[model samples]
Target: RFDMAGVGDSELVEGGLLYVERTRADVVASMDALSERVDSRRFLLMGLCTGAYNAFRAALIDDRVVGCILLDGYSYPSIRSQIEHYRKRVFQLKRWVDFTKRKLGIDTPSGSAVQGDLVVFENEVVSKERFAGELQSLIDRNVRLLLVYTGLGPLSFTYRRQLHDAFPKIALDDVATVHFYPAADHTFTLPGHRQRLLDDLDTWLADEFESETAARG
Candidate 1:
């Protein structure tokens, strides 16, 4: 996928929340251009981390987006998730081994951060009700969602079905597709983890849109 303005190597230009307006405009422009040359108008948006949040907001604003693939995106604080996260951390021998290595300066963990001052990012303050509302709106528009979380994500998303637990009132557990890879970090640092992510993505893409020749914008 192409980078939104102010992202990647592109020159930074600030806009509204999460740069939604600029991103929306850029995406729509690309969609129009793509549609002129392609047979289908429907679109799918797949993004990671901040890109995922941007894609999600863009989908809400644009009806052409038929589906979204969100990786290591939004999640909220919940007791169950906290328990699960710490429980695994405390019980897993590998976790302690890795921690000891880091503590001993034998292993330095790689970060998934963009070294720049142009764009500022903080945790999004999205309440459960608001998030549920937005999700329902997308659902009403027939936008299929594939939500995936990695080990570096929020504690609340430790389990595959925790999305529902985070928002029990929503029917997302039954409706939305969710996956979790506890071994994978936010950026899939390991080769095996990256391959697993690609494999899962391929299967999801095939299962959802194999019959339709749609543009993935």
Candidate 2:
């Protein structure tokens, strides 16, 4: 699976994961380019974190995507809400840095312990950036997709409700299952959890593929 632009190894020239809108646009571009070469009708899209949001959005726009698997991500909300949340953490970090400089009379980094909390909160806001109007759009297209969100993170409750309301065919229990994870972190990179999650995914995917194959036969 290829990583989209401005992510992982594909960092932007400006540096840092600051511009989320640009990243979403890049994902869209990549999807459009990829669709040209393959049969859109058969392609299956899967992603983790922000990539999950991208895959869902791509499926909504391009009819070629037959299925999607999303892991540990938020649903669509206004970019404004995301931006405001992001700014709060950034300002906090900046305050800590400035306070240290003023008190110490020199520029020095704050204690690691304090920095850690800031990082967690920062991640919360960062996840929201990729959550554009994609989930709602996906339901509108009647896309067959599985969205996995953790019970442990800072997800928008409103958005989750919106997802359930949008897809009446998808019951609340199914939606609860879709956002499965032992922990509420972004990726659930914890030990053993990854494998367990993957195993569940493998079973679900096998079922889907088998059903498709049977229909074709």
Q: Which TM-score value belongs to model 1?
A: 0.74
TM-score winner among the candidates?
1
* Model 2, span 1-217: residue lDDT tens: 7665645787554545544555556666666677687734367778876676566556666676767887754544345535655676677776677677868898555577445533332223524224334444554555566667664554542233444543444443322336455354666768677777778788777765777778887
> Which residue pairs in model 2 clash with each other?
40-64, 41-64, 149-179, 152-184
At residue 121, what lDDT does model 1 achieve?
A: 37
> Residue-pair clashes per candidate, as listed?
0, 4
lDDT of 1 by residue, 49-133 (tens): 7778778878888899999999887776467877976786689786587678877888544533321211223345567788889
Root mean square deviation (Cα) for candidate 1: 7.0
The segments of candidate 1 whose C-alpha lies over 4 angstroms from its true place after superposition are: 9-18, 85-124, 154-156, 213-217
